[model samples]
Target: MDNRVLYERLGGVFAIAAVVDDFIDRVLSSPALNANPLVREAHHRVAPAGFKYLVTEQLCHAAGGPQRYTGRDMKTSHAELRISEDEWQAFLDLLKQSLDKFRVPLREQGEIFAIVQSTQTDIVV
Candidate 1:
């Protein structure tokens, strides 16, 4: 069995950051997610680079990398946006697209999905 942590398997910070960069760009440009005025406003308010940085940090930490996530909790970050089930699914679809773009293997995708799923309750209102 492969003994390396998910972070290492994912090629550590650089690879993970690349994925996050794509994912965040996809998210920020998604009409489905921005349909909600609150979400649209939030997306417009945040700097894309900083948003990517936070997401990369979060994923890196979740995947057992050395970086610590310094962003707010999922609930606090998403609470006012009031994300819906459909919107959440749309977000997942974008995530899948990003992972596919990176050619991330099934195992790594599953692990990443698990981490994202764990935060769903906090993110979805």
Candidate 2:
């Protein structure tokens, strides 16, 4: 029985970073997410490259890669935004689009979805 981690299965940090880049771009441009003033302000204030770097680190860590995420935790980072269920759903939709664009396998996508979903309680108000 093989026991390869999700990070290896997904082709490691580079692949994960590519997905994160697209996902972050989609999220930053989302009208639904930016509708919240707090979200809008943060999106505009943060440099896109830095945002992508943090997100890539986080995703790599979550996917069981060697990278350690140095950014703020999910709750602290998102708390002020007052994210709603609708916005969260929109974010997930964007994630799905990004994964689909990269042709991530269904099994891997499910694993990634579970990892992201684990943060739902912290992210959604």
Candidate 3:
């Protein structure tokens, strides 16, 4: 079975998108994260749909789906962000809330979280 289908059976890309959107919003609003301030570009604020799309693309590929993410590598993309452990923790917190809100089963949540976590190498300061 396609990973996308499995993710769909679990919830689908839309579900992941929704969670990511909420997570981004929460992260942007919370100052508890000392590092990794919101992206300065006006575009990132006015509309995160593009970022959301890229996130989903990365996710689909990470989950063993058919889609491929041709976007910039995490290291290159996040190089300028200068994210820190606190900011990364904030992201994880928001993601946890989203997963809980979505009521994703534990097993599937772990799989998806693991995929999101794959970027740790680049996301951390």
Each candidate's clash count: 0, 0, 0
Task: Tell me the tens digit of each residue's lDDT in model 1 across 1-104.
Answer: 67899999999999999999989999999999999899999999999999999999999999999999999999999999989999999999999999999999
lDDT of 2 by residue, 35-109 (tens): 999999999999999999998998889888999999999999988999999999999999999999999999999
Q: Which has the greatest lDDT?
A: 1
Q: Which candidate has the highest TM-score of all? A: 1
Model 3, residue 111: distance off in Å is 1.2
Write candidate 3's Cα lDDT for 34-105 as tens digits.
333444443354456677778777776676566688778989887777777776777788888877887877
Q: Could you arrange the candidates by TM-score from highest to lowest? A: 1, 2, 3
Q: What TM-score, to 2 decimals, does candidate 2 have?
A: 0.96
Task: Give the TM-score comparing model 3 with the true structure, all chains together.
Answer: 0.78
**Which window of ten consecutive residues has the lowest lDDT sum in model 1?**
1-10
Q: Which candidate, 1 or 2, would have the higher lDDT against the true structure?
A: 1
Model 3 residue pairs with clashes: none
lDDT of 1: 0.95
| Model 1 misplaced stretches (Cα beyond 4 Å) | none
> Residue 119 error for model 2, in Å?
0.6
